[model samples]
Target: MRAAELHGQRHVVVNVVDDVPPPKPDEVKIRIGAVALNHIDVWSWRGMAFAKRELPIILGAEAAGEVVDVGDAVEDLFRGDTVAIYGARTCGTCAPCREGRDNFCEGPQAMYGFHIDGFLRTHVNVPARIAVKAPKGLDVMAAACAPITFGTVEHMLFDNAGLKAGETVLVHAGGSGIGTAAIQLAKAVGATVITTVGTAEKAKKAAALGADHVINYREERVEGRVRKITGRRGVDVVFEHVGPATWEGSIMSLKRGGRLVTCGSTTGVAQSTNLYLLFQQQLRLIGSFGCRMQNMRDVMEKMAKGLVAPTIDTVIRLDEIEKGLARLEARDVFGKIVVAL
Candidate 1:
């Protein structure tokens, strides 16, 4: 078996590894087919890990695979089933996990591709409970994004922010992976989407992705445009991810009593907020992390229904991960990138 491992900061190697043994009790052995890249991969490559981790860690967070074997305890699943692996290793006994809020697990945090060996390998074993059956007819590349890209948007917009149809939303970095997913999902639900892009080219792409309005932040005032497009009412929800670079503008673009859901801080994190404005508007700033296992199921349902689709920018082999990571770090992508195993 082959695995892509991070040896050190900015160092990745594709090496042959021993084949994973058959599934243990309550586990499933999978042959990974496709892996999706996220900004977290870039962060790890740049040594921005927020917690303790060992080197030579396998490097892929979102992926879909075929079940080669299932443990004896597993009943509902069988060999040759295609499934999407949830990215995190949550303690199933925790209060939050019991309530279906797996993202808020109380036990030790072991995020795949971050805290432990991940799906970059050809074969791996994971708890059967964490795998969601990929919707029938969903290919490996599309299902690969279910764990992160679409799942995060589903959780942030519907679960956390409570975004409703006909309401307006401001999605920052509309060219990024999650950004593209946000645009399609928001639009699919009949929400008016206002998105910001870094370049003029991406602005056009955002428009094509059902964005009601596109702001080239590099050349225009995004806040001004959002206000004008909404007739000064501002947007009902702000889909924020870029950190300090657009933090103030994201706040300004929201209407009074509006909701803001954030999942990433690709830019620098430090930023100031207006305390008076925050209190005056009764605004809700929700900080969202990864999605629950159910969120992945919800997004996959949408994918199966053709209500939303993954916008893949490119596909790379396992050995070309460095180049893919470099492009992602430089913000030089139009949509999600996948690695085919």
Candidate 2:
């Protein structure tokens, strides 16, 4: 079997391992089919990780695969079933995990490609508890983005922010992977979507993706545009991910008593906020990460039903992963970059 391992910053090696290992009593042996790249992969490759991790870690966070073998205890999943593997290693016995709030694991914090070996390899065994069955109509490439790209938006918009139909939302970096997901999902529910992009090309694509209003942040101020588009008022919800660089604008784009949900801090983490505005507006700021197990199933159902679609920018071979990662870091992509195993 072959696996791409990250030894240090800007270093990735394709190494041939011994034979494939068998699954444990509660695990499933998965032959990974496709892997999706996220900012987390770029962060690890650039030595921006803030957690404790050993070297030579397999570097993929989101992926989908087929069941080559199932453990004796695995009952629901079987051989030849295509499934989306969850990205985190959470304690299933915890209160949150048992209650389906998987992102709020009460046990040790572990994420694939960050805390432990990931699914970038040809063969790997994972606990059957975390494997989600891909819907019948979703393909490997689209399923690969569900675990993170779509699931994150599902949890952030519905669970945390409670975005509703007829509402208005401001999605930052609307041309990015999660940004594209946020825009489509909001629009699918009849919400008016306002999105930000860096280029006119992306702005045009975002409009085609059902964005009601597109703002080129590089050419104009995001807050000013949001206010003008909303007729001097602000949006009911703000879908935020770009941090620090657009933090103030995100805060200013919200209506009174609006909700702002964030899942990433791509630019920088340390930033300032105004206390007076925080209390005066009665705004809700939510910090979200990952998603519930049900969120994956929900996203897959939406994909299968054609209510929402995966916005894949390109597909690359396994060895071309480094090039894909470089493009992701350069912000040269409009949607997701999937690497076929």
Candidate 3:
């Protein structure tokens, strides 16, 4: 088997590995087909991980694979079934896990691709409980994106933010993978989407993705454009993930009593918010992390029907992961970069 391992900061090397062991009674052996690159992969490649982890760790967080073998206890998933592996290592016995809110698991959790070996290998063992089956007609490339790309947006907009159909939303970095998903999802729900992009090309693409308004943050003031587009009323929700660089503007873009949901902070994380505005506006600030496994299932079902799809920037060979990471780190990709295994 072949695997991509991170031995040090900004270093990823391809290495040939021995055969994988058989699956445990509660696990399934998977032959990975595609890996979707996310900002977490870039963070790990840049050694930005806050926790302690061993080097030479396999480095992929989102992926789709075929079941080559299923343990005796795993009856629902069978051999040859395609599935999406959940990104986190959650304890099924915990209260949150039992409630389908796996992201809020009280047990100590280590995220794959950051704190543990990930799915960037030819073969990996997945817990059957966490492997959500992909719809029959969907391809691996699209199914691979369900875990992080689309599922995060589904959890943020619908679950935490409780966004309604008639409201307006401001999505930051509309060119990024999750950003593109946010715009499309908000549009599907009949919301007016206002997004910020860094370049003219991204702005044009964002508009094509059903964004009602696009702001070139590099050339124009983002908050001003958002306010004007909303007719000085401000937006009802802010789909924020860019972190501290855009935090203040995201706050300013939202209407009074509006909701702000965030998942990732690609930029520096520490940012100060005004106490006065928070009290006066009665705004709601919510911090969202990873999505539950059910979120992936819902995302894949939508992909099968073409309701929502990943905006693929390009597909690269397995060994070309470094190129993908570099592209994501530079904020140059307009959409997702998928690795074909």
True-structure RMSD, every candidate: 0.8, 0.9, 0.9
Off by over 4 Å in 2: none
For every model in order, what is the number of clashing pairs? Answer: 0, 0, 0
After aligning candidate 3 to the native by TM-score, how far in Å is the CA of 268 from where it should be?
A: 0.7
Model 3 — which ten-residue stretch has the worst lDDT? Answer: 47-56
Reference-based TM-score of each model: 0.99, 0.98, 0.98
Against the reference, the lDDT scores of all candidates come to: 0.92, 0.92, 0.91
Off by over 4 Å in 3: none
Query: Residues 1-341, candidate 2, lDDT per residue (tens digit)?
Result: 88888888978888887656789989999999999999999998887658589998889999999999999999999998889999998899989989998988998878999888888889889999999999886788888989999999999999999999999999999989999999999998889999999999999999999999999999999999899999978999999898999999999999999999999999988899987998999999999999998999999999999999989999998788789999999999999999898
Instruction: Give candidate 3's root-mean-square deviation (CA, Å).
Output: 0.9
- In model 1, the runs with Cα more than 4 Å from the true position are none
